[model samples]
Target: MKKVIIAGGTGFIGTYFEKRFNDIGYDVKIISRHPHNIQWDDKKAIVEALEGSELLINLAGKSVNCRYNEKNMKEIMSSRIKTTNILGKCILDCNNPPKVWMNSSTATIYRHAEDRPMTEENGEIGTGFSVDVATNWEKEFFSFNLPKTRKLALRTAIVLGKNGGVIIPYRNLTRFGLGGIQGNGKQKFSWIHIEDLFQIVLFLNNRNDLEGVFNCSSPNPVSNAELMKLLREEMNVKIGLPAPKWMLEIGAAVIRTETELVLKSRWVLPEKLEKEGFIFTYNTLDKTLRNIL
Candidate 1:
């Protein structure tokens, strides 16, 4: 049977990938801290998992949905760097390494561009804590010398899916009449449906010629104001109370997450993926919101 290994396979994205792969007849192995999964400390098991596998996906990192305090900052950086380094080492130990390795990277690596969209070929790298983390994470991932394996970094945007990801929070906001435009509502909301994201994974696995960084987002990026209006329309909510920047700051403090998650203008485009003929099922915000809602 075909084999695929997913590191940090307990999270929302990983879980979905596992199911999709399994349903399609791939033998999926998970490396996670959770019981019944291969533990991170077990290098032998990791090496075993990578050997002769068709593909390896590394999503092992701390969630960035928290206040960037001293401890969380250190953890967020270390978690990604350490796991990536370990995987690199294990791949080196493999006699027959996986054909392709897809590492998770964030679209937040690019600057908050409101004027134009950022692509893999022309995107300007941003500075700051989150940007630093993303830069270093990709740096670590590509540092490996796997001559047999193709390496690709998935710079995924906010994923919209049923019962998980940012969709749940957005759905709650719209339901409670708080789905108004966040901040000035000018921030570009770059997003992808979960199904399209999954299909991209399959597409990349087959396209052995493709490597390096690829932005995973819808081509039809919308403004924050437009996003809220569409969400209300789809969800049948008439009155959405817009949260100003000041109110968002307070709410973010109360929620223990950063405002950058919503306020930043992530205008990213999947130029490489589209140029290679990858089609997104949910290309527009309305189509995505309708499916998820």
Candidate 2:
């Protein structure tokens, strides 16, 4: 069995990665601040795990949805960068570095497109809260100078699952029949089904040569208004409530980040993943919505 080490393996994405890798005959060891079963400090634990491992995945970070002030921003940036820096040091210490080091990244790296789809080859490098956070995070990750580790930086879009990530807040509002288009409602919403995300992780692990950055999202990107329609329809709720942009700005600012995220207009497409011939089980928004519901 291939041994694998996961830092921040207890987080939102980390938990999912753990279950998938563990079920497939891989010896998985996780490093976390509060270990549920196996625990280790990132630097020391990574060196130990790298001894006979095939892969190492880093998924540590503070939530980006909270306030983006000076303090919270620092925490968000530090959490990702610091953890990876520790992992880099550990990899340096390793007698033999793992075949691959897959780290969590964000689609927020792309600059805002007016309405064009942001492919891996042509994704915009925006400079807002999302872009700033993502840029700084990636900077810290690459600061480590370990050339041997086959690095996989996954630029992930908003994940849509029945239970978590970008779904919770949207589900809450949709439950109350408040699901509607935000701002102009034309903001592009790039998303992937939870299962598709898990499958992508597995696919990346299996493919050794597939290194560098890859965008993880459905080929079909939906607009904010369209996504709202689907969510309401999926829940069998009445088509009610159009959240004005000003209301989102003033009322429930964080709660309305969904509106902002959706309204931001990111037409992101996974050109590289597609070019690499990765098939998605749930590629359509309605199909994904039905599965989750």
Candidate 3:
């Protein structure tokens, strides 16, 4: 069986990948802070895990669902950079390193643009703490010299799934009748079904010619109003209370998550994936929502 090492494999995406790979006959090994398979601090264990592995995927990072205060901001950046740096070092030292390394990156690195979609080739990187974190994370990921390894930074958008992910909160809001248009409702919400995300990974793994950054999102992005309308319809809800920017800010503070998560316009496009002829199972908003709901 092919060996696969997934760093920080305890989270939602990691767990999903673990099962998917396992189902396909890959021996999936998870490395985390806790000792599920191997602890993060165990250098010898991590090195042993990576030895002769076919793929190395690092999804290790602090959750950005909290208030971006001084301490949380520092931690968020440190967690991602530190884990990636460690993995690069290990891969370099390995006698037989993994052929492919897929690191986690966010589409939030693009500026809040309602005008155009951000693609791998011609996307404009944004400023501020979120973008800075993403920039540095990718920098560290590609900084290492691994001639044998094909590296890819997954610039992922909001991933929707039935089990656990951003979908849970959205579903909860819809059930409570608060799943309405946020702000002026013009913000673009670029997302992908969880299955499509896994497929993209598989697609890239199969195509050795593809490398570097690939935006992992649905091509058909919808505005905030349209997204909420679809969510309401999916949940069979008649009414949903709209939230102004001011109200969103207050709610974000109460929930301890950043308002930018919902307010920012993330119009990311999977140009590279599409150009390579990767077909998404749930391409449209309505179809994706129906599958998830």
User: How do the residues 195-249 of candidate 2 rate in per-residue lDDT, one tens digit apiece?
Assistant: 8988887788888778878899999988888999998998999965988888777
* Clashing pairs in model 3, backbone N/Cα/C closer than 3 A: none
> Candidate 1: what lDDT?
0.94
State the lDDT at 159 in candidate 2.
87
Stretches of candidate 3 exceeding 4 Å from the true structure: none
lDDT of each: 0.94, 0.80, 0.93
The list of candidate 1 runs beyond 4 A from truth reads none
Per residue, candidate 3 scores C-alpha lDDT tens digits across 1-293 of 89999999999999999999999999999999875579878888888989999899999999999999999999999999999999998888889889999999999999999999899889999989999999999999999989989999999999998898889998889899998889999999999998999999889988999899999999999999999999999899999999999999998999999999999999999999999999999999999999888
Clashes of each: 0, 6, 0
Query: The CA-based lDDT of model 2 is what?
Result: 0.80
Worst 10 residues of 2 by lDDT: 251-260
Which residue pairs in candidate 1 collide? none
- Runs of candidate 2 with Cα error greater than 4 angstroms are 35-42, 254-259
TM-score of each: 0.99, 0.92, 0.99
Question: In lDDT terms, which candidate is top?
Answer: 1
- In model 2, the clashing pairs are 110-124, 110-126, 111-124, 111-125, 111-126, 118-267
Decoy 3 TM-score against native: 0.99
